[model samples]
Target chain A: MLIAKVIGTTISTIKDPTLTGRKLLILRQADIDGVPFGKPYVAVDTLDAGVGDLVLTAHGSSGRQTEITKNRPVDAVIMAVIDHLEISNRVTYRKE
Target chain B: MLIAKVIGTTISTIKDPTLTGRKLLILRQADIDGVPFGKPYVAVDTLDAGVGDLVLTAHGSSGRQTEITKNRPVDAVIMAVIDHLEISNRVTYRKE
Candidate 1:
């Protein structure tokens, strides 16, 4: 799973039929501190997460494990919304 | 699919049971010209690709579509060895 920050959303008209009405969001990998970086990629959003929310994304086939994304051509899916992050027992990030 | 260059190999004894005896190679993403950049990642090599070879990798569940990687825990797989790359009617790279 990648710790990522939801940066924005995507609107696609002509896409795989399996992806119709799916919510695809733009994301960038984030560090444990919840700071975002790197090139952005799109992932199917199943959890009603909004922009600026730090979330956990499952990639590959695991993205299809969810009922909403099953058998879809999508490669990434937002599986969890991060409430906070801790490293070595020290809180590094907390949802605002 | 990503254009990547195999840089090295990995030797792991303790890993997911599904990955036992798999050939996991290290790779870095490459441009159409075959120049490598960014961080290195591991992928199951199903096509006997070797170091210095520019190959195409299928990521996510697509990596599991192959017979060698089916149901495995890996997220990436080398699916094709690139012989050459062309862009805009020009060959950008050719195997030596």
Candidate 2:
């Protein structure tokens, strides 16, 4: 799973039927220090994560394992919201 | 999905139970012209793709959507073997 920050939401009225009712959020992949990088991509929101929330994103088929996304054609999903992150024995980020 | 090339295989004796019997291959992410970049990662092979084969890889949750990967903890999966790729009316690659 990649650490990312929820930057914005995507509004798509015309899409696959299975994608209906799914909340799409724009995610900017972040480095270990929580710095955002690369181009942002849209992902399905499963944990009610809001913008600015740090999240763990599951991409591809793993994105569809959630109950709401099962058998769907979704490619990316926010699987968990990060309360804190530690790397190399040091705290990098903490929610709140 | 991202385009990649199969470079090698991975052997894991200890892993998630759901990953048993899964074939793991090392994939090098490739650019539009099939030039590899960044570090390589392991992905579950669902399409029987061989080494050097150009494939389309699905990541995260989307990786588990295949029949063999359902409910697995795998983060990447080769979902398709590319027969050809074209961009801007130019043929970039064609399987031989």
TM-score of chain A of each: 0.97, 0.94
Q: Give the Å error, residue B85, model 1.
A: 29
Model 2 RMSD in Å is 9.5
Off by over 4 Å in 1: B1-60, B63-96
**Clash count in backbone of candidate 1:** 3
Give TM per candidate: 0.54, 0.54
Per-residue lDDT of candidate 2, residues B1-96 (tens digit): 999987765443433445567777666789877777865555789989988888999876677788997786457889999988899999998888
Interface DockQ of each model? 0.08, 0.10
Best by lDDT: 1
- Write candidate 2's Cα lDDT for A55-78 as tens digits: 766666766666777788877777
Give me the displacement of residue A59 in model 2, in angstroms.
1.2
> With candidate 2 superimposed using the best TM-score fit, by how many Å does residue B4's alpha carbon deviate from the native?
18
RMSD of 1: 9.8
TM-score of candidate 1 on Cα atoms, chains taken together: 0.54
